[model samples]
Target: MGWRTVLVNTHSKLSYKNNHLVFQTGIQTEMIHLSEIDSIILETTNISITSMLIKRLVDEKINLVFCDDKALPLANLMPFYGRYNNSLELKKQIDWAQEKKEEVWLEVLRQKLINQSRLLFKREKDDQGKRIEEFSCQIERNDPTNREAHAARLYFNTLFGLSFSRQEETDINAGLNYGYSLLLSIFAREIVLNGCRTELGLMHHSQLNNFNLASDLMEPFRVLVDEIVLENQEEKFKQIKKAILALVQNTYPYKGHLNST
Candidate 1:
């Protein structure tokens, strides 16, 4: 069987039991097979971990990703499996996803813009204490057909503060976002060959798709490297190392369980 992630918080004990996963918030947890774990992310609120668990997780060739107080990944540990044919496929997947992905991203940005606009409007004008409804008509029924002009309008009217360039924010947003997509290509390829089905997106998935679910899961905090690297575009680095243990130590729980962005 392949590995799965085990995120620990709240001072727990963990181990393996014949390929079944087991861990506890208390002491002397049931045995857990190391082989069953694909990875482990240790995030503790008030618990000290045993060294044994760390040793086992490392020895089993399982990945380990770490997070911070914001539930964003601070670091990841992947066992070195030799480079395969995946890189070429990764480039192709990237090219395919770029066009459609941006169309989708722009739609997403538009929604965020509407929300932001409403927030600004509500604060500026008393547009609250009343039911606000959204309709398709809210989107331009006959939006600009002129690509540059349409894009410019969307930038100024829709997204003003997201990018520094006022004149080319739409394209700039597109460029930054498109760059992230290419970045995700690296993640998607790994998750796929790592025996993951990427299509089961955490937030946006229609049926009949097969990869990038891991990409979907990884999106919110994709900017970890971006903010560090001065935006997400940079010549590849050996690792975006953010050290998992100390980072995740500060995070709180999500709905009683610790999760990463």
Candidate 2:
């Protein structure tokens, strides 16, 4: 797999040249070997990509994220199918029983709460961490009691003080939303590659959103960005953005294998 997350922030015309992705801006042009790029982030509205290059990127299973005029990610390019029997896999995904889906979602919530508890422990809030751990252990199938919400209320208040609100428009909230959006895109790509629809979720069932599954899968990983924000709470938006992007390279041990999450 490729390792580079290519960011195209400047106005450029992208095309396919030989085996490289050619970028032209004004009088200058540059070539990036396509094999070395894991993903491409079109961070500017002024960028244009050739159809040929787009096809090649899809063939290579390279993730492509597109940002809006305000430089916030809004969409991503996912292929119609995965590398294997995508139709069969999707059928199986659609046929998943509600009982099994609920069971899986119960585990997802359990892990998310566990991670939140660990984050609290790391921040020296042992009492709060124990409470969260208790909540994690008490989670029923599909979180029927909504302990996740109760835990989130305590988690945010204990960590960010009583005044902190994720709903308010603040630099901390902006940084966190941006980082979680990027993480959601990553999870969306993985779901598509596994022949599952991002619109279908294990627990999340927002009718208006297309990335419900991504949101569900990204719950446990959210603590990573939370840690980043805690470490650089006073930093401005730009630095936080760069720090979040840099986190793509960090690997985690999962199921006897290393994962770039």
Best by lDDT: 2
Local distance difference test scores for all models? 0.43, 0.87
TM-score list, all predictions: 0.32, 0.94
| lDDT (tens digit, per residue) of candidate 2 on 37-74 | 88888988999899999999998888899998877789
| Best prediction by TM-score | 2
Q: Which stretches of candidate 2 lie over 4 Å from their true place?
A: 255-257
Question: In model 2, what is the error at residue 251, expressed in angstroms?
Answer: 1.5
RMSD to native, candidate 2 = 1.5
On residues 44-118, what C-alpha lDDT tens digit does candidate 1 reach at each position? 434355555555554565555554553333445443331456566545544555456555544543443344334
Worst 10 residues of 2 by lDDT: 240-249
- Per-candidate clashes come to 14, 0
